[model samples]
Target: ASPADMAHIAAANPAAVQGLLADLEAMAQELLAYRADSSLDTAGATIRAQAARIAELERDAARYRAMRDGLVSGDLENNPIGEAMYELGERVCRERGHDAIPTAAEFDAAIDTAMKQPTCTCPSGDGSLSWPCPQHPPEVT
Candidate 1:
């Protein structure tokens, strides 16, 4: 019950009211002590970390949602340029006509695999590829 209801009951029963008021006072003291002992700084740090992780998870969720929607709707198939490119790549690949067409998953996996590999074959070989080298980019070697 609310404080107002309790107050009314206490007014009608003095002994019972006194006991209830005493209990409330004891509870308030305990709450204050707990508040004083709690570490606000530690709580703030934990809250910040949790918020950052939630934001990162939200971004990953959006990425997966886009991938799922793309697969279900075949938005790539509807684009004329994309369709032409797909047909061109299919023609270039030396596969049998009866072979299965590569899905978006296969294309994504291939691109990811390629991105993880070294780009240049020329081994001046500092374990680093030359960017805009004299033989490469004509403007800024």
Candidate 2:
């Protein structure tokens, strides 16, 4: 999280204690998976990088756990963004059909689309959206 986001949280007084806890749990699970894989047959640079990432994730999860504990014990207002993030994370964990983990085909499609220069196929057909179609000059980056 950026300092600006932290400041916003403080200002918004987000009552995101449960959300924070959920985030911590999710991160812990992910880190555990990384740790397990790294400890197994994996070797070389990839394993090293995975181990390092897990370490960082563990540290971060600790921070969030502390924050969740603090929020539960302290007085705070509701943090919409935090709650939304938690809900999204929980939804993913539950595997609610809304967001199933991408399979190889989905991943390949994403890569293919990303690699292709974005084409604007909007109804407007104005040359001001993407490229290789009609629109150009992307609206926002």
Candidate 3:
């Protein structure tokens, strides 16, 4: 109530004003007791724990996204060997026709076989063949 209303009530009945003040004081005490209780502290701890977990999950999601992008993009910074292998596989697929595109296991087996082949030395004494020999074109550099 406004001061004027309180004054009017006090003037009309001082006892009633005293009762109103007592009620207000009791309410204030109740509020103070509630604040002093441990429930608020427990609630705050729970909120903080949940917030920390959410932040950790967000960080994990970001890391996974970065890993997924790295794999899908085949960028040199993240997967240089994967990028090179993909390019070599793509070239092979194009040269042999799309219908003959190798499965993952087949491609791995083909790579293993190629790696096991003996290096071919050119018969010419010029020694012009590259490091891998005449089977592969001469290295440009």
Candidate 4:
């Protein structure tokens, strides 16, 4: 209705106008409540996602720590190759400082390269057989 018509009706029936206003106010309050509930639902989902990500990160960190410890202690597989690699890693760390500890991927690559090298039967001048054939040492690249 036009403003003029509404004003005329309101003046003629003030009680009806008051009732409509009350209904409109209640509808506005309900809409506000619904909006607040929707926002809370969205926030809850975000919090859940972040919590899951944190848990995943914690698991990854634990696995990495275990791998690092195994590699450093030469107890990963209790084999010759593992012992050689651990000794080599220790020597490198001693020479280059602890900050030079290789990541798991780098260590794996080095092991793969060492395994691919041909074995040598000839003993060194010191009467000891070193890893990676000694004569044809695995390239560091």
lDDT of 1: 0.60
Which candidate has the top score in TM-score?
4
lDDT of 1 by residue, 1-141 (tens): 999998887787978878889999999999887886676767888999999999977755654554465457877755433444465458546574546666655554433343343433444524445543435454432
Model 1 stretches astray by more than 4 angstroms = 1-38, 78-141
Q: By lDDT, rank the candidates, best first.
A: 4, 3, 1, 2
lDDT (Cα, tens digit) per residue for candidate 2, span 6-118? 98877566567667777999999999999987867466777799899999777556545644654576544454324434555565557757566645454333333333344
The superposed Cα distance between candidate 2 and the true structure at residue 113, in angstroms, equals 44
TM-scores, each model vs. reference: 0.31, 0.24, 0.32, 0.47
- How many clashes would you count in candidate 2? 8
Report lDDT (CA) for all predictions: 0.60, 0.59, 0.64, 0.69
lDDT of 3 by residue, 13-74 (tens): 96887888899999999988888776888899999999999997775565455446557885
Clashing pairs in 4: none
Clash pairs, candidate 2, are: 14-78, 14-79, 15-77, 15-78, 15-79, 127-136, 128-136, 129-136
Tens-digit lDDT string for candidate 4 (53-116) = 9997775565456456656786556544566577768977988898787766656555555444
